[model samples]
Each structure stands twice: as structure tokens, then as C-alpha cells.
Target: MLHYIENSKTQVGKELVLMDIGAEYHGYTADVTRTVPASGKFSPEQRVIYDLVYRAQEAGIAACKANNDFWAPHKAAAEVINKGLTALGIIKNETDKHPYFPHGTSHYLGLDVHDRGTYGPLKAGTVITVEPGIYIPEGSPCDRKWWGIAVRIEDDILITANGPENLSAKAPRKAEEIEKLMIEESAFNQLELPKLD
Candidate 1:
């Protein structure tokens, strides 16, 4: 979903807002995503889902090291997601297919969001993204209270011999940190953009 969706009616007191965005610097591109509560605060259910995704992303990032295969991070992320979803009764067990999280956790991010890197062993100096998500739209098999909740915490990670370095560290990812930053007044709050047709 690399397209913009217009929803000017969106405002405070909303549920979740996912900003799956990217930027181009000179020629190289960077992909980053930050999911936040629309009301500058998270409801109990939203917080639960958000935290699960955050933990899964962390696990995925931790697995992104030199000598590890590209699938290493995905495997690690899926394990966390399966356990979390199982605890919530969203699934039977960790060995389940894990329908909630159905995407790759890491991918090469450079000239394009999915860079042209060899699908082999990870090496130092490679930059990748760790994005784990849980999408339970309406009509999902989970409890009704868990419906309409989707969250993903993404970060540009630099693979190194030492460990993974989060390039987008300054951007808040935790539920509380995002709330704090959202509460802080922004310059854009004063300026208004013209309505689109």
C-alpha cells in the first residue's frame, strides 16, 4: 500500500493512524513507518496491539546481524507474533499460520523501498527495514473488541558486525513516547492546508 489515502474527516478521538511513508535523498530512498493513536492517546485495546507489534519489530531487528540469513528476522518476528496472538486467544498456538502478521519483517532499503540486494547472507553495512504488523480489520475471527485494530512499527536498521543500529531512532515508537510527542504542539497545528476536491 504505497499510495496516499485521503481522509480529511479524520480528527481527534480516532483509533489508529498508520504512516507508511518514505523519502528520497538525492537518489537513495528511505522507508519508515510509525503507527500512532489518532487521539494522541491509545485506548486499552489499541495499546495492546501496538505493544505486540513493537515487541515483534524489536525481535526482528535483533535478528538482523551479519551472517544471518534474510529469513532469520522474519522467523524471529513470526515467533513473537504467534506467541502474543496465542496468548490473546487470537490463534490456537504459536505454531499456527499466524494470519495476523502476514508480511516480511525485513527488506533491503536503498534506491527503492525494496532495494536490489542479493537474497543471501546478511553482511555489515547493509541497510534494511524492520516492520512487523498486525491487521485485524472488521469481521476478523478474533473478538469484536479486537477488530479494526492494525499496527506496525517500522525502523531503518543498519546491519553491522556489532549489532543493528536504528537509523530512525529519534522518531518515537513506544506507545507513551508517541503520545508524548503527539501532545507536543506542532507548527503545522497553526497552519491549515487547502481542502482537496
Candidate 2:
């Protein structure tokens, strides 16, 4: 559910679509990810999870400052997610080994999509990504309403002496902002492509 099959004949419907995209300019590549509701509106339950993930991403981004260890972001994000999931009863307690958040929350970015680094303390001028997510697939242990819900929000952060700077700040992450943006016409709507047989 985190990604779509290439050219799959399926519709997004009212479900959420997660796009993990990367762009290259000159020699460096930038990676970004965003999840949006297909209906341009989020169900109440979906909004809860999305908002929780958003808060977790914020915590992670805050840990992206210089002098922090490379793992600081993931630790901060995981702490928020663990507590949020506990409050939602998705996990029995904060210490429960839940499957909801199963990945690291940050990584280096530069020439390579996943740029190489020492994985040591963060330093000024370092560019990285802070992504936090919660995935509840069908038939999960929790209530049926949370089933098939997956949300991920990623932002590129630059480690600085002052603090972290969001390079992708222009991209909308708020539910209201996304809903507003979705109301606009997409330039791709007019494109026509030949069918491959």
C-alpha cells in the first residue's frame, strides 16, 4: 500500500496515495515523499493518523540540528509515534513492539538519492530527509476502521548552526492545505499519451 504497481489498472478512489519521488538537477538528487487523499478530503480516522504522523515528523525535524547524532531524528519520531499509537489503543502500551512504524525516520541526501555519510553526529551543511509514517494494513489487530490506512510525510531538512531548514517547505503537508491544493486543475489533465500494445 506504500507504493503503486507500475501501470497497474487500478484507481486511487477515496484511498490515500503515497508518492515517493526524487528529482535530479545538475549532479545532486533530491528526494521527497507525500501522501494525499484521493477524494481531496480525509475521513476523521484518516485525519487522526495523518495528524499524528505530522507531529512525529515535526519532532524528527527538530532533531535534525547540528551536533545531534544521526539516529536522533528516528528516536524522536519513534517516541512520538509510540506514544500516539498507545493513546489510540492500536498498541496495548507504549513499549509494545508494534508494526505500525517499521522504518527509520531520516537519511542523508545529496548526489546519490541516499547519499553516503559517516552516520556520525550531524554537521552543518548536511542535507537529510525526515520522514515519519504509520501503516495499518487490512485486518490489523486494531479496529476495522483503521484498516488499510497508511500515511507518510517527508521533508528535506538542512542541518545548520542555527537549526534545521526545510528545503521542501513550499509543499503542503496540512490536511486543509492539501484539500485546497487538490481543488486546483492539474496541468497533466490535458496530456495525451499513446497506448502501448
Candidate 3:
């Protein structure tokens, strides 16, 4: 799906594209998502929100373990996100009631984007997605400096005997890395196309 944001107040805007891809090998499927700035470089406000979400995702990943329930990662990430919004003065109090962060931090990932059976303790072979996002719709009570910024960071994770493993870690998750990667030309760009009616 595509989410476009335009804000005169923040003096910046972005066409955010969110995609989920799945591949199968030996009858097993994997799902992953990567979000990047359409402009190739994040504005100051965008960077702030993106970084906060990145940190929250890290916390969520850390919570993935054989001993923790499926909801543990959500709880850990939500705590960080809620506190971050408050510390940035985006909200009135230290609470997770903020409308900006409305979704759970994770969900099962396998053959489907949201796989089934995400209820009890996580299993060692289970795969899940840790995605934390902030969406500030226009005309909110917050200052204009924080207007029209939306960011979502997602990674496919595996609960292992040692700890959580980021299967998509090779993908760029940081703002700088994303910007650099975006600027590089892709091999597909060189493909020749024939005019067919």
C-alpha cells in the first residue's frame, strides 16, 4: 500500500510505500517488509520519527524469546514508543493512549503477512514481524513542527534458542543506509523493453 503525506508546516512531505514480499523454498515461506523515503533522504522531522520507531523495533526484537509470550514484544515496543512521544512533548502525559501509535508491535509471519496462532509463548522455529510506527494526521493538537510525519519499520524475526535473529538484517533499516541505497542504480533499470500492443 502507498501512504502520501504533504505538510506545509513541516516544509516537507513524502510518498511512503509499504510492501510485503514472500518467497518459498522447499515448501517453506518467508515474509518481509522494508519502508523507505521516496525522496531518498528523510527530512529532519521525518528522521526524528523514523529513528524513534527504529529504536522501538529494536526493543520489540529483544523481547522475542522462547520464554516470552507472543505479546511480550508488543508490550516492550509500545512502552518505548509511548515514552518517546511523551519525552518529545508530542503528548500530554506518559501513556500509550496516543492516537498516533495505534497498532500492535508484531504479528506472525510465514505463508501470510499475518500468520495464525500468535497467542502463547513463542516457539523456537516461529517467525514474526516487529513493526512499530507513528502516524500523525494533519490538524492535530501537537505543534506544527511535528505535523504530517509517518514512519513504519518492520523486520522479519526468528525466535531462536540463543535469542532473536533478524532474518532481514541485510536490508537497510536506517535512514542513512536507505538514502544511500536508493541513490544507487538498480540492475532492473537497465532492462530493455519492446513496444508491444
Candidate 2, residue 102: Cα displacement in angstroms equals: 1.0
Candidate 2 lDDT, 113-186, residue by residue in tens: 89999999999999999999999989999999999999999899999999999999999988889989989999
Q: Write the per-residue lDDT of candidate 1 for residues 1-197, one digit (tens) a residue.
A: 22237656445467788888889999988889998888888989999989998899889999999999988888888888989999999888788775677778888988888998997989999999999899887888878999888888889999999999999998988888999998899888799999999
Per-residue lDDT of model 3, residues 85-188, tens digit only: 88888997876377888888888877666778748899998999888888887887898777767788888899999999999899889878988998999889
Alpha carbon lDDT of residue 149, candidate 3?
A: 74
**Pick by TM-score: which candidate is best?**
2
lDDT of 2: 0.91
lDDT of 1 at 68: 94
What's the residue-level lDDT of 144 in candidate 1? 94
What local lDDT does model 2 show for residue 84? 95
Structure candidate 3, residue pairs in collision? none
Choose the strongest candidate by lDDT: 2
Where in model 1 is the C-alpha error above 4 Å? Answer: 1-13, 190-197
